[model samples]
Target: MSESAASYKQLKEEFVSGLSGGPVGEIVAVTAVLPIAALVWCLLQKRHAFFKPYTALGNVVDYLLNVGAALLAITLYANSAVLLMVLLLVPALFVLGVPPSTGARRKKPKLPPAAKSYNSNDSKDDTGSSSSSRDFDVLSTKPFLTFFRGSMMVLTCLSILAVDFRIFPRRFAKVETWGTSLMDVGVGAFVYSAGLVAARPVLKERAAHAGGRRAMAATLPRRLAQACRHSLPLLVLGVVRLLSVKGLDYAEHVTEYGVHWNFFFTLALLPPFVAIFQSALKIIPSYAALALILGVTYQVVLESTDLKAYILTAPRVDLFSRNREGICSFVGYLAIFLAGQDTGMYVLPRKINPRSGSSNATQRTTLLMTMAIWCSIWSALYFLTTDYKYGAGLSVSRRLANLPYILAVAALGSLQLFTYCLIETLCFPEFYSAADPKAEKEAYNVATSRVLRAYNRNGLAIFLLANVLTGLVNMTVPTLDASPLASMAILVAYSAVLTGVAVTLDAFDMNIKLS
Candidate 1:
């Protein structure tokens, strides 16, 4: 083969094979280290009861330990990490236990008269008004969930890039498997979800301002404008990144982003489009329909023509044909973003009161059921569309973000959310209350563990930090030459440094946001 062809072949082989596969191991290690380190730090601070169950710190420790234990089981016995993670929830729930409830005879807490603004004017009764207000409040208040979302994004980024350096098992990297890898599906879903969550405040504010018949009409233009503003910086960053890779002569995965299609570009562009559609239509169902239609269309086109090969091997890169995967996948990802917005609507309600039947147990049970149903329905859809016997099912192509890929992401993301909710509900029920800001802050500090809160507080900063460090590490270390144990150690140490930096910054109240 010619030098250029030989280079392409080498890159392809490198992408396909590397270290052993270990999605569960990487996830478990990353998740477990921070909380465990925090506990150790707490011990050093002379907090003797940090590991005791029922206390805030103890509850976090319990959850982390359970996660660790479950991961160990998956490593030793189970072939499916997703299934094992779900099954582990049973023991987690049992260990954490349910919140204590007020008896049926106890009267529900009275809402302040002024707080009634959360309710709709059309509410028929006090109970209806209270319910409406509470839901809205919960939607607006949950900082911890936002933090968790950011942290998940950071984790997904680290895992993927780590695999690039052979720091983690190569098998966990993106593959054309029947079911999707967690890391592969996670990164795109998290980015899209973050965009949706970030746009919620803007969406809600716009809707409120345009309350009359023109509400729908007025909101669309404003949201589109807002999305344009959001995308501008990302677009610039994407351009800078594209130029940097080309200029620096870094190893380029052509199919991953194509020549001009950076992730920053996708982030900059897709959310606004999704937001516009959402502003004009019913959010979840509409977007879900779009995803199905687009996915099917893409698949049919792929099978019928040489489009896939052309996209993969096209010589010239430009605004259109060569980057078709990146351009086309935006539709599917927007659908994912819309689905995330629907979830945010559900999980971030205005309030939750044990006395009003919107207790932690109720919420957790609801999320759990939703997760189960979605997973089952999506899995069935996958089997229906593609044959599993010959590994012919929908592959988790980040480039395609096809129907099965979307379903897998939605299901897995839901499972993650459910797990987090369960942990919060059982371990720190007091943190769920929207009424008392002081108490909520205290509960958040305890529930998340100080280190986690730090990471949460400076999520974007931590992500940037990881990227910079990753570059430095690649320059300094022979990553591909390292043993698995050395790679694991390096990853752990890298994560620890990130956690420390985040904690220190959060201590000084240095959390930064571009907008």
Candidate 2:
């Protein structure tokens, strides 16, 4: 047979193969075990040391990471190989802090001579204030670290993996070829990434060890302004999305099925609103309460209305569902995203330190217990919901924020993460060194450098390039092809090619944007 015929036959064979649910489950199980094992081993090795103080830090990071990860999940909904890879890759940024080198170049940790003299003079009465301010400054540097390490690592792994397989859900039987979920993920990623940057100053203020709260407070408005401004690129993307609905004939293309045209429009409206909310949070101290109220209200709407049906299946409209039905109606979800962002801005701290404790072992044990309970609850819910068929019929009363669902999802995630930690610990007890975390980094630097170099040099450019690449890929292929194996293969190929191109361009410091 000719080469073309052979290629077609191979594609046919690939399409015929099904994803073995067992393997998928095992992968999930292993990923969960890695982190859990890591946590345990760390505790065991450091059992002689004190650990309580670090617990808060871990908790804070975990919370932020989860929110960030959830933002990543929006990509999964789109079921795009490109989108999923991006989603999985970007969160690594939040997990790992900025590279050590970036921090070194930014500034010298020095006090102004006048301030030093004033500090010396005031030390007798207000040393505490000065110390507090210093701590805040230290914390502000974390975002850069996280952005560099986590984002690079995650993206590298995801890009490589995309060449191996596509990861997605088995449900959504007749869902579009690609996931409309990318819209959410794209919006969420920008929001979450930018939010982390904005959070740095606020958290720094809280962590400050030397500057008095007054000094920090005085600088906050300016800091907030800078953060908002830095986030403008993402916000602009959102605006483009919103306006696309009006000017772009998004529907003319067959590839547009999974494209939720208005998701970004909704996202475009979040930052400014969040900025306003954050300002209020300074005065009210009720951001959490407000978030709770709004979340609950949104849930109530989901539960009581035919909103979901209308949003998921209906034809297009100007403002509402783009024209489908579901509680995820653009207008409604936008409201939720705005509310969530505000809550996160005002209530979520930038860095969380663990509580000081006398024993590391004890804290580890506590975390493990928490994981066990969370897992139990999640397992229970998964089984219970196995029988609940999701219908297009709108049950206006089933809020997506229903207590059970929220609790279950969180628990499942925690359990999964803990399990992964545990497995990693079992596999390699040492922090990254045991498995040479930098192995990939070095390899990425060498072979993959051409495409990734620019991204490595500057994150913003890489992000734009990545999105454009993803969009182009999405336009080129069927986004929602449901056969798991076939989808996975296609995505893997797509990811591989993109990564190769990205790496090649990065190595050369060629800044290119696919968009």
Candidate 3:
């Protein structure tokens, strides 16, 4: 047999041999700790660079706590009673309605100049109501939002687990149903709409931050130039992948559950448009408005018309089968992702100036409130959608910034960041700086440093590696019908192994490009 066949045979044997719980347990064990170790190594290498050991250590602790978030997602995916309970409990860290203790109350602050000026301007108006001209100030503390974010993060991670492990098979079975088709289109539309909304804020923020027309033009030209530079190589890779021997004939096998041939296509085509959309958020009255419009409209289209059948059944036919339906479906989902980001931003601004006299207790309370809100949402959604299996609809970009697949996206991003933080504290204390120097170390008057600088710097690289690994694992793993425990074990192990390999390869100045 050929080398590839032989490798598959070996993997199969491993699978059979690991039928008991040992392999899966070990896999989880490695995932649970290796990340922390790797983080420690990264930090010590950078320890001499004006870092705060204690603060760095704390960051690491936060990161590990974040890993607990993965359990929330596993529960969502597994839909097991145990997992669900975990999910429910995890969000208590951020829910809003939970009783506030004396330790949790935030003291109100005297209005800062920015707020005072705005109020004075408001009072000057004869009608005292300028809804259209109103400028909503970014809050120093978004207690409600914090909870929402924390809950969403947990739920999102859980969703990823569900999609990958196929825990809730009954929900997944809906893939064969007409309702699934409608849901797909509706979800797709929602994702796309949200993306458009989210883009608005980003664009506005950039435009405002730009010094002047000349300055803005300078940045635009450079950004555009950068895009142009990247495009050529990406195009070439596409062409080669299309004709190469390793090509999987994705078009011919479009119906396969785990096929991920179009990630690059989706990533490349959608972002530019989404960026433009995000800029428009500044003009919109509310990001939620955009989400509602898109969701309602998509729902109407899917349910009230023949769009679903045409998109799903007809698009699969030979003449129309160039993956048009799949592409369309994803476009819709992009809207959802965009919307989620926009809503998130609206609720939680990027910049927050803490009240000068605010007590630490208040800050902690705010954090808990955010966590509580997040938990409630997860719990509610869980109960409501127990029988629903959206079946990894086009809404989820799989691993990359999925939109309507809100649960998965939130969990993964939040927990991933949390884990990253944890590793820094526990394994790599050196990298953690009490003050993030890169956040303009001597900025106007900020006290704390940003949480993710280097990680953000290398984010694209890390994300690409993760995506490729996930794709490869899907391609290599045994069929979904494989033994349940075996499948979960292999997936967990595969994810850990690929992540390790990717990080190591990155360290060595060697990177693998996914086709």
Model 1: residues >4 Å from true position, as ranges? 1-151, 176-179, 206-218, 279-287, 300-306, 313-319, 351-368, 387-393
- Per-residue CA lDDT of model 3 for 1-515, tens digit only, reads 57766575455334322111112222222223323323333333222211223245544433333333343224233334344334434443333234444322332111122211233344433666542213333222221222222222222222322344434233322133222211222223223323423434454454455424333432444544544454454455444544541364211224311123443445455445444443455676654445445544664575578765565456444534545444555544554565455444433432211334344344344443453454354334323332245432333222222233343333223332334333333322221121222222222112111122222223335444444554455556544445667655654554344334433454465634421
For every candidate structure, what is the RMSD over all alpha carbons to the true structure, in angstroms?
8.2, 13.0, 12.7
**lDDT comparing candidate 3 with the true structure:** 0.36
Cα lDDT of candidate 2 equals: 0.36
- What is the TM-score of candidate 1? 0.71
| C-alpha TM-scores of all predictions | 0.71, 0.47, 0.48
Q: Which runs in model 2 stand beyond 4 Å of their true positions? A: 1-137, 140-199, 209-231, 239-260, 279-291, 304-463, 474-493, 497-515
The model with the greatest TM-score is: 1
TM-score of predicted structure 2 = 0.47
The lDDT leader among the candidates is 1
Ranking 1 against 2 by TM-score, winner: 1
Q: Distance (Å) between predicted and true CA of 216, model 2?
A: 5.6
- Better TM-score candidate (2, 3): 3
Each model's lDDT? 0.54, 0.36, 0.36
lDDT of 1 at 101: 34
